[model samples]
Target: MSGDYSIYTGQKRTFTIPDYVLFSLTLAISAGIGLFFAIKDRNNVTSKEYHLGGKNMNILPVAMSLLVTFLSALTLLGTPVEMYNYSTMFWWLCLAFVSAMVLASVVFTPFFYNLQVTSVFQYLELRFSKPVRLLASFIYILQTCTYMSFVLYAPSLALNAVTGFHLWGSVAAVGIVVTLYTALGGMKAVLWANTFQALVIMAGLMAVLIQGSIVTGGFQNAWDIAGNRSRIYFHDFSFDPTTRHSFWSVVIGGSFFWTSLYGINQAQVQKALSCPSVSKAQIAFFVSLPGLILIVSLCCMIGIVMYAFYADCHPMDFNNLITTSDQLLPFFVMDILGHVPGLPGVFVSSLFSGSLSTISSSLNALGAIIPRDIMKPYCCPNISDRSITILSKVIVFMFGGVAIGLAVLASQLGSVMQSSYSVYSVLNGPLFGLFILGMFFPWANAWGALGGALTSLAFMSWIGFGAFANKVSTAKLSPVFTHGCNWSVTTTAMTVTTTLRTTTSFTGSTEVTTIAAPSYPFIPMYKLSYLFYMPTAMAVLVIVGLFVSLITGCRDPKTMDPRLICPLFDRLFPCMPEMILRPLRCGVNHKGNIRNKVYEEADELPEKIQPIDANGVEVKPPHDTEAGVLKGGAINQGFEPIDAKTPGSEECITHL
Candidate 1:
């Protein structure tokens, strides 16, 4: 703990503890607020109101949600660990992250707006067959489940080590809180809570950073110590496929990962799409960018300060503190901030909040996508309104179980986000390409899409493992060193306590058996990074899918399945497809395929009967229960109760 240093100490190693009643009361109050807002409004326009906080959430929470979702707790703790390994070249990753948000807003988001989608993978259905849509949704759900579970578990581990909270108790309590609120309030609860959690998290970190700095003798001392050869700014400009985090590697490779994650992943995009307008969704994409800089900067800076505090002052028996860099922040919170009465509880609650807020959105997204994308196509052609609502809830419960299971399985992985995403990219990276093919490459056929997608995944997986296998062989010579020289001096003492620390190692000694090469290969926790891996995989899937689709002579965009397309895209760009579908005249043996402009004008006239399906394609009109709380129909069915607005509850295909 930085607070344990002599500079800040005047016999303050153990500060005054809070009253037991006060501690429990504050804890209960914090947990209750989180629980109440989440559960109380479950069925109250929850699909929209809860999932997106009814799309009427304030800017603070929206900003917070965006920050928390993109920046995980692992990020909060892991960047520091990496800085302890190398230097501050890791800080440049901040720019890569922000650049991704900009790309999403400018390049990829417009395409999603055109799809007119309720869920992200709705594009798959439009571009391919039922199998494709199911394939993408299933992959995404599996990925999210693994991810959310790991995130949940990571923080519990942090808290358990700090507060002595039972490991399972911490996991289950936090998990239950997340599930109850998310399950009840839907997206609305999630974003609002996210907004709250984001702020608290920042507060806790900033407090630790400033307090840590003050203890280590202000700004210049901290800088001289941290700004040495170990934390040097530049590394290499060349691309190295085998090693991760290079200049070229991040720009191109990271772009692919971000495109698939932000562009298509339902968990992230769904929150934005749940908003009422395309403009709002687009603007929100932009809003999320700047926060990345603040987030990454603060996280990396904390690592710098941590080195300053622990320079010569290693904790009790622990000689090597760098490996526990991730643990340092939480330990600081408990040992330092815990001295303040409500602050410690607030900090812990804040930490738990990240897992809760992000997980809630994941579960809600899984609920919305699974039944609508996969089950509805097979179980019942025309689903009744009542059943549709019931099915969505059932999906929420079912997926909650899957997420928990993934979390438990992922616990052994060193970092939560890294482990889950590595597995996800194999499934995700290939899917984004198919979505792009369907939207822009009108000629992409289902068969071509399938074949190309498979080819892409195959290539990406090979690259990921190849890099993983030959990691030690690729080392550049410009020897990296100047291990932390700042550690010898104590801020309070006139005498310096010098010691050398080139690399961090475990404190207690243990016998080691070294293996030459190729130990166990397919371990899940030991996979490549999700961020880079997914991008490589996604790029291959789209390029191959489009090439194969076009080569197979499937030139008709109309042949593309509707399930793969976004509903938002269609709603906004309806005319383009219609113009293509509108009949063209051969001009009475004139040998030309000119569109009949006059006939097109005539067809634009309103008809007496409305087509059940918008496209002139064969589909079983889903049988809906009597309209429930809809503007035009009777018997409010969807989510509205009959008493309030039961009669004329026919849904008019509403989205956020």
Candidate 2:
């Protein structure tokens, strides 16, 4: 009992004046950005300006914003823990980011940039039906709300270790401030604030690396010590699907995970569409690749460096200060830099920087989506522009409150990195598939898309959630005791402090191993690696979607608007054989393929659709639910009548 008490004492390090000042500065700057934008666009703020920075944002800041938004506090706190506990093999995920970004640049960016829509899910309604769009949007809102809670909770776990601040207090502080900024400045403030926060994230990481190296001799010493303990490793070339960190899993599964986020997710797509043109959006998308790789590499390096610093005497085993991998980085920061006034605060600020950037973007994107996809189309189709803008701000505040409430309920989970990725892979997989079906398979009707999504969701929920619940254990690293570090093991009130740490042969250790009876077995599918969730979900959705479309009498591919299909599909239809492409397009004459002229050229804008009432007075369609394409009156049985001037209708189809 006394030995464990000593461990708690070591962890009770408090922050000084300089530490508080540095942390306060980061929050103040974030709030100030919101104030600047609010004052600048006070009277003229419209839905476009609030949601997309009036579609005139610069390419560089927008790129940085996208990078930081996805790579949140989860990466900063959770990633290093991944390295320390397992091996450095997770570094290969940076390659996954590269592949995902390349795909986004070639395919999704051009489509969204040209569409001129506020929400990315609006593409769902345009391609499929209203229920599909609403389903996708609702999934996004639920996943992001759950994800933001984790983002807020991850950093707070670290904050509590060093500052003695209550965990709930930290969660509330981060969540409330992020909510305020997103509601006040809207999109512009979120973008600019993310740019500044990105720099802070880099600086906080660099400070730890530089100071850690200096305190522990040099980089060479840290590298050699960490390597001696098998910490620096990256050559796992296994093909087994159930293996957690194999090369195939990280490259293929990781790429799919990233693609789901960047390619189809509104949080990222919203920023990509804010640029002036498709070309600029593509440029911004590419720029984020290098920055992402740099930060992830720094995080990986920090993990190895941490192992070197306390290789021989891990605090968890000795001080009992941290039980899970998530707390390891915080333990190291407070232990090493606690004496150096503001340095610990800087590291904490980095965590907040990540959380603030992610939560702000998430809230703003949620605000945009709730109105554009759900409220505008169904509840208030004729809502004025000013009212829509006001409603967006209200949604931001409402969702932000929900995230805080969820964060308060969070407790210790398994590895933070895996916990986050597991949740992402489960929800994002089917959503990404819905977009692919719409773009690549024109014969796919609304019913097929909806059925595919619902089917994938049910299967993944059972397998993914079950696999997650069973794994309550975390992996431990081999300990390597650093010089000058000392710990004492006590039995019956006997204590001896020394620099030597050995797993075996401690006097009166009182440690005993226990073995429990095996529990019920998981089927092979449930036993598969969490990384496979995205690819599996996507495959199920596409396969089921295609089968359903065929059996239910799919629409003719020839009638599909060329704008709805990919440029590659439209141009190569003549050369490609019938068997290679789906049988849905078999009836269409290859020579009669009408190439979408808009995608063929680097045009400035997409063809706009304007609806009019019977009196010839121009009117905007009520909600996306009313504007979607319907088939045989199947799902739209009792819905309101759609305007003929809508884009998916016959009259506007030729113009599209």
Candidate 3:
């Protein structure tokens, strides 16, 4: 009764034993390699060292880690299904890259760099309340828990369906292994493993693509078939709120999504921010842009190739196929290609890497968030760093446990694989909105932050639910020529010349299966293109929060806590750098700006902070619980960057 059961019973013949064994081994090995790294880096690094890699990490692995975070078992298994079912999202990933990298470099990275923060949620506490911070952290934990489970469970289902192993067993082995290494090694370990796994995933797909091409034809043949028959639907510029994949939805929604990811998402944010220098982190953003284009494009081509290969032996029912849609990729690999020994192992390892990298990053982040956001603020305000580190390890177990447990009944999400992004999008837009408000708008009060998040959440839920029901009511679209199609996650390269079109005109003798729920939702959710959900959510948040801030006009408290501010910001945001040109500038927290650090020496004026049209808000801006929107920053109030000696000798704190 799990979410995706439709896949198994009817598609059993297509999924075989060899596939399951290959899939399981990948998860087991990924976990083992991660643990060894954890132990090696154990003593010298603290939890900060463990989780954030002591901020001394390199960029190659960092950028790769980001790439793996976005890709997962879903990409491995479901992408080809998308290729089979509709327009393959080959370039869909490219769209994500253009938007992701630009935002990270131009705007998003600088915001974090300016602040010098560890957790994205921590920014909320500085401007708002502990409650706001905790809410965000809780939402993240919920997001990752559900997300990681499905990530792990997806390949498990693929393994079981192909190899006929129990789903729960697959979930347990992968879950335990990923969690163990993540708990031990922290962020560095996760990134290193991510680098390893990313390679494995790419290698696996290359194998499938190469063998599949020969089985089907050559590149030229695939091009002929795809060009002649396949509907690549590269760009659908006709914009309609109801339509799933369109240019506006991609460009606009994508912009918002990347902004939130780079700016607000804790797991993704930590990896880049963890870098010792700001320049390295910024480079991480640039590195992935090209990679995104290459890999995603290759994936869709592989899908077409799969279709061509199986033109003859043609497995499962076309419309009658019972498996959840995402399972298509796995079904192909196991049932069609599992006959090759090393190939299966490579495929499964790649699948495991995608899931492992993302989940491990999440677990490491949860460790940081729990102590910083909830546990320390409310319960143990003064808990030592060591205690905090120990507690984070415990949280990793909990995060993994819940995800694995849910994985057992994963069939409930109907399309647990696709729903992964939706789960995140639904919450992220609003959550990130709150933070956006804080960073940009000094006037945004705690109450506004709380209200903005609540409102955004409500709006997203309503739309999300409607979309889900629409998916339920609509009819499932299947290929017209049923004889050629087979059932498995990524298997579909048949090249018969039937016009690939679907129309819901079932009449007399047909027994119509209820259309599987929209795999997501339809409430102007705009087709099943939930890919842009987070950015869409972010849009709603920023707009709504800003409007509200204008109405209310409240402001963030001027006073800061001793521990709330990081030492890094003081140097960067010089009006508050505590240390001067000496060794004192090292890692120490400071309250005032470096400029302000002149400490009562210069008769200075406290600058007026222009209100921010801050980050995100629900349906309206919440910048003004204390109240505000976009305006000049606090430093703009008559302050200019001055060398220490000139300002010091003159005893002049000019508000320039």
Please report the candidate that would top lDDT against the real structure: 2
Give me the candidate number with maximum TM-score.
2
Cα error, candidate 1, residue 64 (Å): 3.0
Off by over 4 Å in 3: 1-25, 310-322, 441-443, 470-478, 484-529, 554-656
**TM-scores of the candidates in the order shown:** 0.72, 0.85, 0.75
Candidate 2 lDDT, tens digit per residue, 569-618?
A: 43335467656654544433333122222333332323232332223233
Q: In candidate 3, what are the lDDT values of residues 497-594, reduced to their tens digit?
A: 32221222222223322335434432334353575566556556666665665565443233222122233333244465334622343321232333
What are the lDDT scores of the predictions, listed in order?
Answer: 0.54, 0.74, 0.60
- Two-way TM-score contest, 2 vs 3, winner: 2
Q: Comparing 1 and 3 by TM-score, which wins?
A: 3
lDDT, candidate 1, 259-327, per-residue tens = 566766676676665555546666776776777677778777777766655554444224332234346
Off by over 4 Å in 1: 1-60, 312-325, 332-342, 458-531, 557-656
Indicate the TM-score of model 1: 0.72
Error of 2 at 524 (Å): 2.5
